[model samples]
Target chain A: MSHVYERVALIGLGLIAGSMGLAMKAHGLAGEVVGTARSKDTRDVAVGLGLCDRVTETAAEAAKDADLVVLAVPVGAMGAIAAEIAPHLKPGATVTDVGSVKKHVVEAVSPHLPDTVHFVPGHPLAGTEHSGPHAGFATLFENRWCLLITDAGCEAGAVANLRALWEGMGANVEEMDADHHDLVLAVTSHTPHLIAYTMVGVADDLRRVTDSEVIKYSAAGFRDFTRIAASDPTMWRDVFLTNKEATLEILGRFTEELFALQRAIRTGDGEQLFDYFTRTRAIRRGIIEAGQDTEAPDFGRGTSRK
Target chain B: MSHVYERVALIGLGLIAGSMGLAMKAHGLAGEVVGTARSKDTRDVAVGLGLCDRVTETAAEAAKDADLVVLAVPVGAMGAIAAEIAPHLKPGATVTDVGSVKKHVVEAVSPHLPDTVHFVPGHPLAGTEHSGPHAGFATLFENRWCLLITDAGCEAGAVANLRALWEGMGANVEEMDADHHDLVLAVTSHTPHLIAYTMVGVADDLRRVTDSEVIKYSAAGFRDFTRIAASDPTMWRDVFLTNKEATLEILGRFTEELFALQRAIRTGDGEQLFDYFTRTRAIRRGIIEAGQDTEAPDFGRGTSRK
Candidate 1:
């Protein structure tokens, strides 16, 4: 692909940003990529890994002379980074973010940016439990959906160019409003992550079942929860805190349904339990049919880690 | 490895039973394997796939003169199958099961067994969401745990031979009491499956987020839950019904912990959420270190289902 952005500024040298930098390089979608992180160690490591053409000590320095600036920090940090880079962003630059919670990110970063910059908030719905600069790969976004929040008067040209960059990185881009994006993500991502964290916590707290036993027998099913539960704590904390309402709403519904199943188990209502389980099976089929996940058993996991 | 049993009779031609058949055949752990299922269709498929040397029309016929009888039916069906085969079991034979709930299986099947046969109830901590005869594979139990309930007056030779068969099939065999096994599994498997089913059902029931939306965005994290939720409904229903107390106990504890986290989200308590998440990360690392799971992003699942 041809250069979608002449100069790209990645304001966080974390998993998403590192992956973006590598992907853009692999696809030749960006003429130059510069990255910055609060931690000097992170910046040094990112530079050593060649995640960017060069590393900057500050977000403002990275944003200078950039055609596109990506706010890839934790959601809570977006506002500060945006404020720092506001005066440095080149005129008519397209600014986008890769925060998990779109509404909060837009709200946090938009007020700090100047009118000269086109703000097009985006979230690539792709990640792994691993974090930091070293955890990224070029194919991290392959066949994944990247939702772009374009409700903030983003220019057509800016949005199209950003979409092209994501597509060049192997993601299918879709436009979604911020509010709907938050709610959809609550159902599909935020709520599920919270539940996974909760389940793992409960197992850890149980006195009768030792932690070693939990880890040894995790292949039974609980290990799946742990993979997501082990995600970057600070990033997830920001997600739950910012997207509180939608997550709580979804959790309410989840608890109610869970209570109903619990009652069925207690009452030995086999038919109710059977019917509920049978209905849920259809959704898994739909996911496989949609090509959102593999049909391989246990996600095609081998006994050994790669 | 030499044959552990001269003739092994498998009383149910399902995922666990068929898998055992194939694994035993692969390792030469059983001289001849005979199978039977309530459904003629399942028996036909098992025979067509060569899951057994031959499938009998009745449990008694399969059990006749068999050195090892495996009751691989649902937990709720174990008692009836044990009763049916008790009269036909050979003198000095060994009988085992592959139920998920150990205490319940012991209670359900022990009373029906004759004194001449050694009863060693076992539960293999392995399976896929897919079920029926065709879903079985020779490596399903590879490097997985197989817990044997030796509380019954099982002879040492019988237990040793059963352990050898599981070992030959590439499983790590361990001995655990019935009650302890049930409780441990309630935390690791049963409760997780129930929670997954509940979350998927909630997503399906929500009118605001269409089903297609959930499926399309499942790679965000919800897809992991759906894979386990798609498990055999009948088998899960039997599990919940038979293992009611331990499952209910774990469910209570899970809800308590979940409510605490939910309140943290409600109150915007980032510290509590962050700490809880951080603590859970250790468990995942322990699982990977213990070789219970893969460290690959997304369980090493390819975008395509294989």
Candidate 2:
């Protein structure tokens, strides 16, 4: 099938944007990909790596005449990027994003958009612990879900075109309301990241565990937390700041349940602990069935530090 | 180097026991490896899989005339297994275990031990979500840690020999008082496992998450919890039940910390959350540098998860 857009503009060429640029180039999904970054060093590296056909320092300069524009900055920076590029965007351009939180993005960017263009807010549910243009790859989005959140009054044709662009990059696409999307993600992504970061931090502070012992035994369960905790601090800082209500709600529920389990352990309530352990197993099976993640072996690629 | 034990007997041929049997067989570290199981079906499976040279139903029967007898059963059953085998064990036989909790195992097994026999309680900090004899492999203990805990006047040479046996099975051996081991592990493993089980259970109880979204979006983070919660239910039940005090103490601290972070999020305390996130990244790096775990391309494996 022929590629959809003649020119694709990526504002903020970090991991997500650079990855999209690589996927677009490898799949022939975009005729020309233009990218911009906040720092000159990043733009130089992106240009050197050929992540895009052209690299610029300003969002508006990069978005000039582009058929599609993806706002790929951190959540807190969305409004600023939107404002910078609003005056330069081509008429009828389809604008979307690769942010983790959708409602916040919609609320932040929609007001700055031109009525002539299609604003379809999206989130590609994919990433690794690494960041920056150097960390991206052509197959980064393969087999992952790219969720787009838009409303009834928006241009359905434009949503279809954005969906096609993501599908061409090997991502399965789905749509949901912006608010529901934020809540779903707060459970699946945002809250979990916060909990993991907190747990790892707690372990780090415990004198009895000794930094050596904690790390040595991390494979038991704590290693999983570390991987998530190692994620970009700036990105997550914005995530929690913007998705506050949803994250706090889920986190509140998690603590209530965690305390109950703690009480069970203290009182030696084996039945309650056993029942909880058993119920959670079914969720893992469902994930396998959904074909959303790995089942038996280590969840990710198995390369470990020597 | 020459092999350590001439005849090694394994009591309870489940995942750890079976894996040890396979590792010994692969390395030719033992002249004969016999195993015991409570059920006839398990005995049959063990023999069929060649996990043992001889399979029996009674721990005493397996310990008879053996040079080394290793208890790899649920923690709750350790005392009974120790009592049953003490009288029948060969004079000078070395006994060890792979229980998660250490102090209880020592208390349960030490008093029942005959003077001629040496009892060294151990915990191999390695395993997968899988269970049963079929999950056994020779490499399961490779590069893993086996914490041996005891303060009893067991002979120094005896402990050395047991350490040799574990190292032969591809483990690094460390020593600590059983109580300290329990305290250390509660923070590192037990508390984390309990929290994971509880969080996933909470999601499971909510009808909205269970009907579909939780499983679909679990890849974002919740799936990691399921992988942990799926750990052998009986094994974890015994872990919490046996290591009650330490588990509860660490858990109390965790809830307090989790609550503080929750307040930070609710009140938009970005600095608090950011500091916690930043501090935790060092622990992951410490783990990699310590060689306790790997942090290469795909969790030390080659490629990333699909």
Best by DockQ: 1
Q: Report the lDDT tens digits of candidate 1 across residue range B19-51.
A: 999989988999999999999999999999989
DockQ of 2: 0.58
Q: Which stretches of candidate 1 lie over 4 Å from their true place?
A: A303-306, B303-306
Across A81-123, the per-residue lDDT of candidate 2 in tens digits comes to 9998999989999889888988888899989999988999999
- Provide per-model DockQ scores: 0.65, 0.58
Judged by whole-model lDDT over C-alpha atoms, candidate 1 comes out at: 0.90
Clash pairs (backbone) in predicted model 1: none
Model 2 bad stretches (over 4 Å):
A207-211, A300-306, B207-210, B297-306
* CA shift of A47, model 2, Å: 0.9
Candidate 2 DockQ category? medium
Error of 1 at A2 (Å): 1.9
